[model samples]
Target: MTTVQPTVVSAEAVDVATRGGAGTARRRPRGSRPFRSPQAQELWGWTFVAVPMLLFLTFVIIPVVMAVVLSFTDYAVIGDPEWVGVENYRRILDDPIFWLALRNTVIYTVMFVPLGVLVALGTALLLNRSSRVVNLFRTLFYIPVVASTVATATIWYWLLNPQSGLFNIVLGWFGIDGPAWLYDSKWAMTAIVLMSVWSGFGTNMLIYLGGLQGIPRELYEAVRIDGANAWQSLRHITLPGLSRTTFLISTLLIIGAFQVFDQAYLLTKGGPGNSTLTVVYYIYNQGFGGLKMGYASALSFVLFLIIAVFSILNFRLTSRRQS
Candidate 1:
């Protein structure tokens, strides 16, 4: 009788613990489906990813494929596409205007990249402080980036006026005559370069600020304790630390410089003997203006090649220097 009572009491205790006095959830059956299977989870993940993948395939991949196919054919949007094989590619070799546009683009890239980097770095260094005024100034500098390109170009148009522009007015203060910027071919490109540097450097400056913040303040303090002057500190600590940032900014600048169109289109309109005719502008003129879509596609691929080559070279050079 005692043995049976003890067994019964133990069974009751085990039952109560298993029930957890109604505060605990009931254990699910072994075959219950409260959670998804691995395959179901995987399918849901793919369902979400498929949306963007579908859009990319429909827009980007399809258009690129179509462009490649169309580059070998003559299509003017109205007429049926006629196959021309390598004729368009061959014609590019003899296209003088294309060559001129390429040369002009090269010149713009050369002038803009270094100047843009310097301006952005300088502005970032100036604004790399913690104060209300400095924050306000940073916002002010970034205003140009948020402003519409057309609006910025319009503002610059008035500023670059030959006779009564703000630029010439400022030059008059020093008794130096400012050249007719947009009107004169010699100065037209220079004007474009200046405007580009001003309008685009704001973004680069923000990027530099991010990089600057990432750099350890301890290094600066260490250098100061070692009797390093401002310039020396910048040369050793600041410059070396920002090498990656410089590489990124310069790469972006190079890409944008090569594909310059909006500023030249809005400001110069490729005027004054086509001096400011960039490759992208020429491509625009060819495709839409002249209705030579096939040729334009060919030119686009050529420009793609050029940009790729330059980008690779930049990466290699920057990597070598860093190493």
Candidate 2:
């Protein structure tokens, strides 16, 4: 048998090999630092958002809070403010002018909201089917929105003049006398409402158009295949689908109507015995003309509350209807 000699094992050699392996393993970079914790990531995200949040709070939230506080005080620009509690609100409650303004605002909203929605929906429907000149028609409709309100109001003022207005001229051709539009109290608000509707309908129309496009085409096709007529399809599918947009548009229109000032200010100046005095125009007169800052703030707060309540009611009604 060949001489079987055990290989000599050296302590120094084993130690050297073990130390070398350990050194190599320690020198190799770990694959990447373990991913940052979710908590850390969330902290960084909030840190980035803090700046915009601060700006919004500073500009919007603080102003609203300040207004709310001011609403309860008797503040004049040149004097110290006196806390009056709910006196301003009581005064508003008893003021016939305030009631008139409120009534006018309501009338305007009731008349304009439905009319605006109807016109916008009609325009959107017509445009939805038009492939050619659709953009052109949209631009045409949107022109009034982009145009200067003052300029539009001025032009309409001229067009509704009792004597030389184009409308009256047309009325003359029809052997009918055109009533004074801006001069007559009865027609002043009506004329302004008409102008406002014309100016504002395009915005709501665009919104409705977007809503219409978002609706799935397959629904219409299915309804048609099921022998549904256009009116039925519109009633069941279009109305239901567009409900949210309708609510939004109507709410916005109502709010806007309550704040009607520019047209009234420029065209009628709340003339014909203040028949066209909107709440905002009243506040403006109080604040700027009469220099009743506190009173104006109070009026503004009242308007704010009205808007809030109306919005809440609208939301509740819409929710109930949907349910």
Candidate 3:
């Protein structure tokens, strides 16, 4: 009688406890639910995420939709947006300045991508050792990367200044005359590429540094045991170990180079016969400056398409190389 009564009491206790938790909750046959009301729990779950979800829909979703709709129209931010079908897109094909901007962008990307990767890789290789001095140098290198685009451009503007600038002064010390960087059309883009590489390589350097950590130390020891020199070890192991990192940095560099805007706008202003008029800068000029928002939107999409194609190509090439 006592055993049976204990079992009955225990069962009743568990039932009571389950029902008491989470007000208005139902008792389950087997498992105890943490909350009483499923709907109430669901409501609170949604409440927590409601703000971010609303923001995403409002800003990202709505703007993308508006841009797509506007791309098909001739809205100058004035009267009602006039629907022009594919005329805006068709006009882009015949626009001479569009081609020029694209050519300049391509040139910038070609120069910037390889140089950016090499600088980042070289710096990472140089600084990957475990030492306080290495850490300090790494921090110093990364400082420029975190600086705002405007700030970096302003500093470079002064550094690359003609006649009185630091670059010309240094060149003069070597009995070499530095070309007018900011004013010379032929050299302006080159100067921009150099500045970009210096300013941006630090980020990829960090990425490469992290990738270095993932490489096994025994690999280096194995190479050393085989009488491998520094150059051989680097060529065979270090570069191979960083293939994935290189691919990622290369992809990012391509995207960023294509979107080159702030530097050109702040330092060069697409001057010297529009030598630095990048695709994004051209889009900005047409969209906001000239109030041809619709055409600019179309240009923006074209740029998006170009970036997408290049990104896909990069992925395929890397994958093929790996395979």
| Most TM-score-accurate candidate | 1
What's model 3's overall lDDT? 0.91
Residue-level lDDT tens digits of model 2 in 1-323? 23433333345445556778666456546752336678888999999999999999999999788788877888878888889998888888898898888888787777777788899999998898747789999999888888788989988989998999998999999999999988899998889888988888888899999999988999999999999999999998988888899889878877887788888899888888988888998899888898777788889989988988988888887777666
| Cα lDDT computed for each candidate against the true fold | 0.91, 0.85, 0.91
Rank order (by TM-score, best first): 1, 3, 2
Task: For residues 1-323, write the lDDT of model 3, one tens digit per residue.
Answer: 88789999788768777667653255445554545588877988999999999999999999899889899999999898999999999999999999999999999999999899989999999998998899889999999889888898999999998888999999999999999998999999999999999888898999999999999999999999999999999888887887898789989988888999988998899977999999999999999899999999999999999999999998898777665
Error of 2 at 11 (Å): 53
Per-residue lDDT for 1-323 in model 1, tens only?
Answer: 88789989778657757777453234444553546699888998999999999999999999999889889999898889999999999999999999999999999999999999999999999999888899899999988888777998999999989888999999999999999999999999999999988888899999999999999999999999999999999999998889999999999988888999999999999977999999999999989999999999999999989988998898898788776
Clashes of each: 0, 0, 1
Where is the poorest 10-residue window by lDDT in model 2? 1-10
- Regions of candidate 1 where Cα sits further than 4 Å from its true position: 1-32
Q: What is the lDDT of residue 180 in candidate 2?
A: 91
